[model samples]
Target: KAAGSALMKNEKLVEDIIKSVVNAVNIPVTLKMRTGWNEENKNAPTIAKIAEDNGIKMLAIHGRTRAQKYNGDAEYDTVKKIKGIVSIPVVANGDITSAEKAKKVLDYTGADAVMLGRATQGNPWLVGQINNYITTGKTSKAPSLDKKISLILKHILQIHDFYGHKMGTQLSRKHIFWYSMHLDQEKGSDFWPNINRVSNHSEQYLKFHDFLYSI
Candidate 1:
């Protein structure tokens, strides 16, 4: 719904819809959005005000314009600006790949929170690490090689069970690759192609287990 607003080019309709959705549901309504449709059209502050006025409980702004997608550095100037405009809890999101970066984002934007997207794909522990570091100024210990392998093994089996054998393996492939990427950084991404070749679930599990532990 957020992405659709840029294409529709009508924040008013989006606002109306947001109002309707908020009025219709008992739960609080929240919003997530990029800076705007393009660099010149950074209307985040305007949108933030609209959302707040219409009873949005919280707002999450990705620090990039829609045109940039994942390219370029995320621009937090708008997030900082929006934080000043809206009274609701504001979340700043973009390029937060480490604990210090998350802290910097929160401090710079004066946002209520910092959000992570792609950074937590395989290293889900990062969420806790960043939080603990930010709150306590103590870095959470990264999992050792042995602990990482155990986590990876458990993750794949859970994925396999949730989606079942057929769809689960298909879904698990990309995640398996992500976990592999970090674990085998010394070996390089050549490891991914090897994982892609294993089609069977048991075979894939064994491959992930062996490959991750070997690292």
Candidate 2:
């Protein structure tokens, strides 16, 4: 019905869409897809071939079916299969939360790279850590508590400046929640509840500043 995995149900349609997009674009075309619509219909292999044949330059596959959504563990056997069947560069995505996990996914799936998503929500340094571990075999130290607080406050300020106070205050809540996940739980519990109620940028900023320093 929609324009995503639902389209995967019809192979001819998938091919037509891919060909159309590839022909319409001057830039290299890429595809990001799930394994399939459900457990019984994992057509990623078939779709991957269709995409490559239609001139898709690269692929990134999240190792879960559309039905599975974000609920269970992500499987890589399908991704491994896709990599083996396709000559184009493939990047593996899903549940790559740590540097070791990133390397393991790449090694296991033979993917060209691993994409980080939810794990990087508040921890931007995770990318550097993964790169360092992949290239140097060393884990980068986590930022100090003070450093985390500074970054969180700076991020909130930037959001406020960019989107103005109303929308920025609303948007900053999720980032704050994610960043707080790395901090003391008791303090986070208190801070989040209080911050969630604040509707103004200045008050939100002041409360966050006070909360972070209070830790």
Candidate 3:
């Protein structure tokens, strides 16, 4: 839906803006963009060259075009094409769920780097794990059940502190949902809709602890 009317839909205008910002700033300027407005207009290569010509220091492209909106597997051919067309560093993004997938994307696209977004919601340590594997070619052990439960609780509390109780609890619902998605695989399934309904900090903690102690 958003892809149909992206703010950066006009390539020429966006290129002009990038040129102005590049000329105006002393610091490096980077551009992040989708493949195009839709499948018919996968103009990532065109925009990558424009940014390079306009002095962008780097380019990061999500493998899925704007229209795809994370519905399917990310395609690396476009990123590879963009890298071929531009001399500046290009980073590939999308569906990099694990360290192995990260390595696979880098190897397939020959991208200068890889980026993560949705994969890091409650699993922030994934970045460290991915980095360790990428740099050392050795897999790190997954966090223990107790450690993961502790981390999820800590994460909810951090959000509560940062956003204040009301907004934080509301914002935390999705994070808790994602966290539970992983937890269900390990622990015997139980808390779900019941757990997500918890909005207040005290109640959330109570329910979380109950879920943990029960199993």
lDDT values, one for every candidate: 0.85, 0.90, 0.82
Please give, for residues 1-215, the per-residue lDDT of candidate 2 as tens digits: 66787877888988988899999989999999999999999999999999999999999999999999799999999999999999999989999999999999988999999988899987888998999999999999878888878888989999999998999999998988777765766778767888898998899899878877888
TM of each candidate vs. truth: 0.92, 0.91, 0.85
| After superposition, candidate 1 runs with Cα above 4 Å error | 1-8, 186-188
Write model 3 residue lDDT over 1-215, tens digit each, in one string. 32332744787787778889998989999988888878898888888898899899999998777777778888899999998889999999888999999999998889999999999876777998999999999999778878888877888789889999888888877877677666674442456767677767778767766776555
Candidate 3 worst ten-residue window by lDDT: 1-10
Write the candidate numbers in order of decreasing TM-score. Answer: 1, 2, 3
Per-residue lDDT, model 1, residue 198, is 77
Query: How many backbone clashes are present in model 1?
Result: 0
TM-score of 2: 0.91
Q: Model 2, which residues run further than 4 Å from truth?
A: none
**Candidate 1 residue-wise lDDT, 59-145, digit = tens:** 999988888878999989999999998899999998899998999899999999999988987788899999999999988888787
Q: Which candidate model has the greater TM-score, 1 or 2?
A: 1
Candidate 3 global TM-score: 0.85
Candidate that would win on lDDT: 2
Q: Model 2 clash tally?
A: 0
